[model samples]
Target: MPCGGGESLEGDAAIYRQLLSISGHRPKVVLICARATELPCEEIAAALLALGAGKVETLTLGARTDGEKPAFLETVENADAVLLLARQPLRLSTLLGGTSLARLLRRRNAEGMPVAGSAAGAALLAEHMLAGGESGPTPRMGGVMLAPGLGLSNRIVIDQGGLLGDRLGRLLAALALNPFALGLGLDADTAAFIGPDNVLEVIGSGALTIVDPADIGHSNIADAAHNAPISMLNLRMHVLVHGARYDLDFRRPLG
Candidate 1:
């Protein structure tokens, strides 16, 4: 699930319940706030506990010693659910990259453990992450930057906290570069519960924007000058609200 950040706990109540259910009522949830060093883990942990998590453990990444790394990986490996909090995606990649914790998280996700990320957390879940870029107006060739992510999913590239920021251009630029990947722009308080089959069900008070460039007719992205505005034709976009669903494989909204 990709949350658009800001008061997401209340906005994502239904998703929280669903995640808890997936955990079989009570779950050992590990909250990783490695990217947001300024935020207090205790506060986030309290919120998760109040949301009905069976047990909550906060893991801070940067300060850990070599001796502490093993225990940290073990903690994550044993979790029934793992939540990546909102922050800068680049920081998450820097801290968790090549670490045992990253490897274990991937393994657990493959083993069916529920993993949810909000904002930057959501961006890191994709194989290619949108690190940073200008928002508002049309997309520009150099306006967006792409970086390696956690490799959770290659079919989709996510951009969160978008509606408020008018970051659709960022998502568009990402898809222009990687036409094979679907672009998802999650508004605040919104989420997409992507299933194993890559069918995403929308939930929350806001909307989820899906951008598919599979049939684009034209674009100057390949030859556009650095920082120049990009032009494209025949791009498809879908605006979905709560209870709506989309099929990534078919690149269309599901009825």
Candidate 2:
């Protein structure tokens, strides 16, 4: 999967060319999002065409209803890889795959196809995700925690800046509640193209924020109420600026 660092036209075009090469020319590019109508998809399609993508297709997961059948995973299987647009909703369940996004993810994992997500797109790729919706102060969380993603990387992703306002604190708090994963906060227009070797390479023009809590002195989640401010916490974070690279092959601080 290719991650164009920024939203610049030139940058996206360049990445599209690289992606075309990576996928062996014949690639199926899947654009997943709820507000597909509002985005500049036509421009994106043209860019992909210039980059040598055999075909570019967009799937609207938000338009589907309970009675309608979801798009087939075979459609994705035939493509070189999938590209999930930022803000695309990805959800999953046991009885049935809730969304087309969820079904596609499951299919990719089963076949071991390369997958990539931007912002919310990236968040859904994680083992567990912070489900956003209408609710009280407490946000509900549920997804395939152990679901085998495209296996691009295992680091947990958090979308920040835009839709996720001041999400870092909440993410850190969540990590305190469940201390077994590394947190990556991707700013708007920023992306870390993670390879199978666990190497995170900054691609976009923005920054990739990493929160590793291995050395935190103390966390006050014991008595903290829901949505309450956390205290007495020590944490370290690294900002991977554009063009920089860090290896996640070994779970340690990015050196």
Candidate 3:
């Protein structure tokens, strides 16, 4: 339960309550903020240690050069679980999306190590990763979606706030470019954890807005690259109230 503003002492303490329960108490959490320059890493490290982690460490993956690949892998492998803090925006393609940190988080299910993140943290775990925003009359190759995120979120995007104003339309435009994505707008303090079985369950106080464009028809994305107008499409979206569960695997509306 890391906050968008990483200065949350109370929130950090509260998050431990959930983490401890999830880990049966005293879980070893490897808190990673590979792109954090805005906050003091020492403070985050201290907070995790106080949260009853058996062990905790921080990583600056944003600064990692190509040569540090081996060491990075070893550090991630030794961790029991990885928690990516959404302290900064992330570029998925710049990192190849299969790096050590990303790979380790993906194996959380098989290894029994839970991977959790908030905001950008949550966004990075989806099956499709939206690295950054691009503005043009037409979509370009500057932004590309990668397959099978860390697998923590399947094929979804975590929009931390409700789609107010033109956000919804922009998301629709995004889908016009990549039709296979599911854009989820999560209200503040709310989270959707997609289980290993692909069930998306809502947690926390606010609502989870899900825009599922799986039904969109397209032979290839190349057509869109040429700024071709998309055909008629049906996008199924849902606003899951708190404490509700939606099965993402079946693509059927929840009962």
Highest TM-score model number: 1
Q: Supply the TM-score for candidate 3.
A: 0.71
For residues 203-233, write the lDDT of model 1, one tens digit per residue. Answer: 7888888888999888999899998888978
Model 2 C-alpha lDDT per residue in residues 1-255, reported as the tens digit of each score: 324224576755545555566566567776655544344667777777777778888655544452134343555656676766654334322211354545656566456566766445566566555444322223223211223333233456454434233556556655665566676766656666666567777765566777777667776667666556555356777877867777664655454
Counted clashes in each candidate structure: 0, 3, 2
- The residue pairs in collision within model 3 are 34-61, 127-154
Per-candidate RMSD, Å: 2.0, 5.4, 4.7
Over 4 Å off, model 3:
1-16, 39-51, 66-72, 91-96, 134-154, 161-163, 216-233, 252-255
Model 2 misplaced stretches (Cα beyond 4 Å): 1-11, 14-18, 35-37, 62-71, 86-104, 107-112, 132-154, 163-165, 253-255
Residues 43-162, model 3: lDDT tens digits: 756776777777777766665363147766676677666676654335432452655556555665466666666556656655555444433332333333333445554455544423
Score candidate 3 by lDDT. Answer: 0.55
Model 1 gets an lDDT of: 0.80
Q: Model 1, poorest ten-residue lDDT window? A: 59-68
What TM-score fits each model?
A: 0.93, 0.73, 0.71
Worst 10 residues of 2 by lDDT: 135-144
